[model samples]
Target chain A: MDEHAHPSVMTFVAVWITLLFFTGLTVFAATLELGPFNAIVALGIATIKALLVVLFFMELHYSTALTKVIAIAAIFFFMLLAGLTLSDYLTRGWSTYPSTH
Target chain B: MPDSETVSNNLKHHFANLEQQTATSKFGMWLFLATEVMFFGGMFVSYLVYRLSYYNAWVAGSQTMEITLGATNTAVLICSSLTMVMAVHFAKLGKRKLTAIFLIATLVLGMTFLGIKGVEYYKHWVHHEVPGPNFHFEHEGNFDPRHVSIFFTLYFAMTGMHALHMVIGVGLLSWLLILNALERFSAEYNSPVEIVGLYWHFVDVIWIYLFPLLYLISHRHTG
Candidate 1:
């Protein structure tokens, strides 16, 4: 088999089970009071699950190098979108409302 | 390539061989999925900004979500993704019958997800949570209905856009199913099945994020 071939059945099943486990864990983590860490943990678990799907189920792991670059670019630009916007919102109050700050 | 015979019957003259054709098709699909990421990304950014401003309303609105149904749908969608990938594998192996079977299984699972979502929407409608003329949400901790409406508004927008994609997905699958029955697919010419599988998995990934953000926002029993 070529290095760029689809994953084995065992790999697919393992990834699926891992995804399900993370879903349950995220749900359970939400029940406890972890304060802000709760959101961080939930999103963290979700990012893990999403990475598994992208890498295996979507076959980006087995895809060509060019395909991999395009796929990674999507995430890079998405971060740019979120990071730049949040920077503005997080700093908007710093200049005008020092009393609240 | 022995598979070259199958390719010639179906391949367009534009491509050099089946391998090139498949790679090009997949590249295009990934490009489309990337744009989709940004499409859904806009709603997510707005939701985050509003959520930061009205954390209380997000909690109140989120608490009303049906976690049981949402969680079950998440599991169901993951199951569908597995089936979708299996379909692609079997298609690549030239096992047309098995490929069709798995495709059908994926379609069934996808519909089941949409059906559960419908039940959740019906419940929202019954509770006056639809965010329109009949919209009404009351809370004890001085939560404003306006801000709460904002939560449901984004909720519906994001999930509604997602559901629309699912609807389009099932339609795409149905077309593939028809083409399969017509014997339009082969190991070297199965780009349609493979490409649609990518689309199906992408939709599943969207729900992966949606499940927690929408349903499990604050499931604290004490609160």
Candidate 2:
């Protein structure tokens, strides 16, 4: 839509800088004592980094709306699979143990 | 109104132009990546169940892996991903030579990743960290030998699958380089470059997540 359809040099530099930032952030987070929150914070930063690579670096931002929908559906389905599978395991009852009953 | 007086570029195709072609190719690659996410999703589920069920055993297994190598491989793959994107940029701008250089660099780095991974696997084989009977490696204060098998299972499963992807990606890039050499990819028709770049970056993204989970989680902090 702008003068250039392809990403300019500046966009490329900015994305690389963002990646470096996330890399440093991930390492720093690992150094701290976040306990249960460590994995949470790490995955959060990762998702943001992946989004940047997808939208700008991979040129999803310049894509047609229909293609964007297809891309989004794929990721959404992956998340769906991850969530449902984890929940099934976490919610299972241990009724097989006679000591509890 | 007719082509008798019109140039060859006059008529519009189903898509608007070259930009639209690039867009569709990019989208198709992303959709394909979505399926890959599902592919790895099944493995992650296996990891989650076994990991939770054998919590200490998983940690024991995780301890056998060399974090430094894992971290180093992560950085290497990240560099390759950057090269891959640069290759796409060059292709879009009609620079075949630069694109080929970047693509070749990407392939080399990808192979470098596989080489290092092979070394790690060899170490597993030597140290008996690989899964199956009599395969066990445990640190004095960090793990139980019995539980190390689960760790090795996850270690091989995740990284092994990742290595498989890298092998396939390198082959694809080699083929792309040949196609580029033959003048198949150009500024006007660079969908293949775009598609391959998507695959390469998706692999990098998966490794980005893998590095943290596999390498950096318990750096002398876990009990």
Candidate 3:
């Protein structure tokens, strides 16, 4: 908090523009016939938007190292949670439940 | 009391300096937000699981989502995040009036988002999309209505929880507005504003993911 780089007004506005552009890009991407890639693209653009907000709008870029670690740890654990659950589900051969029942 | 003089400077007796105080407060807020990340992460994981299980219903359910409304709300929330950061900026710069103004703007934009969400909810209710005894999803032969009900259930659960966060954020902003009006924050002591900005921006971040996962699943043109 001491002598941290306070982002100028222009930076905030620039990030806003970038976020809006990405939002439009996601909507545009959804209209394309990309199959599974569409979901990837949507989530990819969303991750970019979330990163921008977290780093800039939330000022994590200017935060202390400890704070940055905490933030990153949160994402890491969330990934672990989702990854483990999905792995279990995706790798299962026996379908305990019917899809159309 | 000797502490009275220090208290007048807005520095708590336990903290060594204002810098330590600010950093500690921000650290605590970040910790709280970390837990919030986990809270919402569970919901997101559940969403992914169900989406994988019922891919068609998820996509079809998502298609029924009013992209126009969802996208509009995304933009509104983004604007609100901008205003929230601006509020933090003004608070740090000790510009009380600008801080209050930006906080109000954030509040207004947040409410606008919720209003759009309300309209979308009303539309769902009329269309019988609510997940209850009357829940009816108009789907083709490929997808199951029961799974579509699950989609709507997750949709409402995710976005409803999000809207609830927005409601709490609006209430926090109102409180900050009152404090701002009282001239409680200045350049040296604006932790409340900054911390609340973090919360508001986190809420915005949640919606950023929600928009795509729940609304933009599949919007390709069908002949």
Candidate 4:
């Protein structure tokens, strides 16, 4: 518990405000018909908001390099899960296979 | 006991020092959170596949959601995360009373979020939005009824799982509050508070993604 490492009250408040601002931005962006960009923009804002919470509120910013690596690894693996699975789903029709049914 | 003297008393026999013990506990929490990320990741990926396949139904189903309530719940969760971190800060500073106060504030905010979610659930129930035979969407003509029901299924499953996490978090905080009252934690040993803070913040992070992914899809055209 390093006293110097603790975040200031102002920092927490600022992060809170920023998270709220991003939440509003996501909702607003969703309302706009940006075609494919709508999901991208909404998720992009959400990722930023999640990053702020992770770094500040979760104190990952003050944590060690090992801790940072572990955190990033979690996200990386999750993306792998999403990406690999989506690839299979998206390309399922590219090759024909006999239906079990 | 004096604060300096208490530091040694707090050190576990298996750990070399307080720093190692704290780091180990934090690492354990991170590992648990990593598993949690995969747990929710599975659901989110399923959602993505279905959403892409049933784009119009997903959009129509998302439009039926009450954005105001969802946004308000997001704000509440964000504020709760703030209070939770402040509680950890105060606990580390050995300000027992402030730590307890902030923890209670977080608990109340968590309950408030759940209460709003309950209200939303009730509204859905009355509107026949729950996925089953009674399910009804005002925009049913625009998309397949089954796909729209699939959207609601994902909605309930995702948000319900999230709410369950919040409930568990509230329980954890309540126990922590009790421990704080018992003078169990001090500046020398606040790992429990810090670890729980990690968990609470992780839940908030999930909602940060869930808010947009579930509630904000195609809201402008539908609402």
Candidate 5:
């Protein structure tokens, strides 16, 4: 096989194991009703899954340190987008004063 | 004459090497994912506004959905993402046969997801719960029908968009497979596979948020 014709990167079995764990974690999270913490736990597990995907599948682990930082920044920026939007919504009606009867 | 083995033949002229080409492709994919997040952001805003206004109605509306199915889809999607990673890994390892195989598996699972989604949609249809001009579900004794309607509206908009991406992703991997079959993709130029993997995972990521927001919101009880 031509060197350029095929890459040599082989994924590890551990990657599959960890991914399965997170999938289980997500299903488990759904089983529990944590009130507000429900989203928090789900998102937290998602973040972990996202991290594993970025660090391993993308090969950020072996890349230059700066590249890793850039990858993390890209992810956090997405979170920021979600965070800002949610905050704007969750905060609305918080400051509204009801008229006294 | 430069043989295909020469770097010139494998990498685009603008890129200095295969790595550069892959990097650029990955960067472009991430940029696209950013815009996608914003696209879904608008729907989230709508959900917030309406759910806040009719809190109890929204709760009642959520009850119509089957949590088990939502949960199953979420798991299916995550598993597909892992397979996508494996496909990229095979591409990197220069295993042409394995690469094609894994990519095909990922594509099949994606299609299965769409198939399951269609079934769920059908279930919604038979129940007359799908929102639109023909929607006919009663919100029982105390809930506003409109709020439940809004839930289905957002549901269709968001998940429908997600299913569309799954379609596109399957198409993308199909193209990649064709290239692999032609021996155009190898370790040197597997960026296309890597980039496609990025896109496929990003789709999964979007669903991750959607599952919780759409299905689990305000449901502290498993009732």
Candidate 6:
């Protein structure tokens, strides 16, 4: 792998513009009434912004497969943390446990 | 010269080649960032649980935040990330002066973010928004002050942790600036710059999520 072939400045500038656009979009989107959909939309836009930064600015797009897998693994575990915990918290009231008293 | 022996002097004796060294450094950085994800993830979970349990109170607490400052800080961080990526790009091109200039630009933007954050914190303090005895949540509806204080607790915990990382990032950038001044990096051995860029971008990414989760969650209610 020739490590010297970095992303051109144009590519970085383009990514920067896209990131700023998404930032504005997320903030603006929050100002609209969307009920439960508001959070979903905000987080969705944020995820896209995060992916752009990860792929372009971090050079993961040009990295090796192992590095890519390592990155995915990190996200996988983070999801596990959030998902598993939220599942419990969201469902804790479904059935009542017998009181110790 | 043998290919192995021809590798740059910056290649460590233990590594087979420059590529290996660079990959190892990147792998280590990603792994460290993974740990940081968990570190912040805990707080996020805490916030989610409390938010679900006390929805209106969370909204009330979020409304107290200054949207202008939060939005401005987000833009500042996004621009700083651009400078950081530019620094890494120049380092790869062996342009020492450009890299140093971008690094300095990133440092300035990072400090600007902290300055704005300090002002926000000061405003909260003046308004008695801190989560303890002096804390108060002003709302015209049925909301428990204690639960609203919980929102502030999460706010301080999450943003305070994020700010701490920014402070550490500024310190690391300062060290990189000194090293760059001494000509310690070149095209073949700018892994430190690239690695630091990963750390800096990861910090920015954390805020990318934090901005929406903390400030924009219930913005329309107050708007």
Worst 10 residues of 3 chain B by lDDT: B1-10
lDDT by residue for model 5 over B1-223, one digit each (tens)? 2224534556778887776676677667766766676677677667766766666666666667777788778778777877888888777767888998888889888988898889889999998878888888674656668768878888898899999999999899899989888777665567788888878887887787777667665544555
Q: In model 5, what lDDT does residue B38 have? A: 68
Task: Please identify model 3 stretches exceeding 4 Å from their true place.
Answer: A94-101, B1-9, B220-223
Error of 2 at B154 (Å): 2.4
Clash number for candidate 2: 1
User: What residue runs in model 2 are displaced by over 4 Å at the alpha carbon?
Assistant: A1-4, A94-101, B1-22, B139-146, B221-223
Give the C-alpha miss distance for residue B159 in model 4, angstroms: 0.6
lDDT, residue A46, model 1: 86
- Over A23-89, each residue of candidate 1 has an lDDT whose tens digit, in order, gives 8999899998998888888889988999899999998888888888888898988899999988888
Residue A24 lDDT (model 6)? 90
Q: Report lDDT (Cα) of residue A43, candidate 2.
A: 84
Q: What CAPRI grade goes to candidate 3?
A: medium
User: For model 5, how does the per-residue alpha-carbon lDDT over A12-98 read when each residue is reduced to its tens digit?
Assistant: 456656866776777677667676587688778777776766666655565545455565665566567657876776676765421
> Candidate 5 at residue B182, lDDT?
78
Q: What is the C-alpha lDDT of each candidate?
A: 0.87, 0.76, 0.89, 0.89, 0.72, 0.87
The candidate maximizing lDDT is 3
| Model 3 lDDT per residue over B1-223, tens place | 1323323567888998877898898899999999989999999999998988888888888888888888889999999999999999989888999998899999999999999999999999999999999898766858788999999988898999999999999999999999888777877778889999999999999999999999999894643
Taking the tens digit of each residue's C-alpha lDDT, what string does model 2 give over B115-170?
A: 99999889888887777975856456543666557666776888889889999999
Q: TM per model?
A: 0.94, 0.85, 0.94, 0.93, 0.82, 0.93
User: Which 10 consecutive residues of model 2 chain A have the lowest summed lDDT?
Assistant: A92-101
Looking at model 4 chain B, report the run of 10 residues with the lowest lDDT sum: B1-10
Candidate 2 reaches a DockQ of 0.39
> For model 5 chain B, where is the 10-residue window of minimal lDDT?
B1-10
Task: Estimate, for each residue in B17-90, the C-alpha lDDT of model 4 and write its tens digit.
Answer: 88899899999999999999999999999899888778788878887788999999999999999999899999
lDDT of 1 by residue, B99-176 (tens): 889999999999999999999999999999999899998866656778899999999998999999999999998998
Supply candidate 6's per-residue lDDT for B105.
99
- The DockQ figures for the candidates are 0.53, 0.39, 0.64, 0.52, 0.25, 0.46
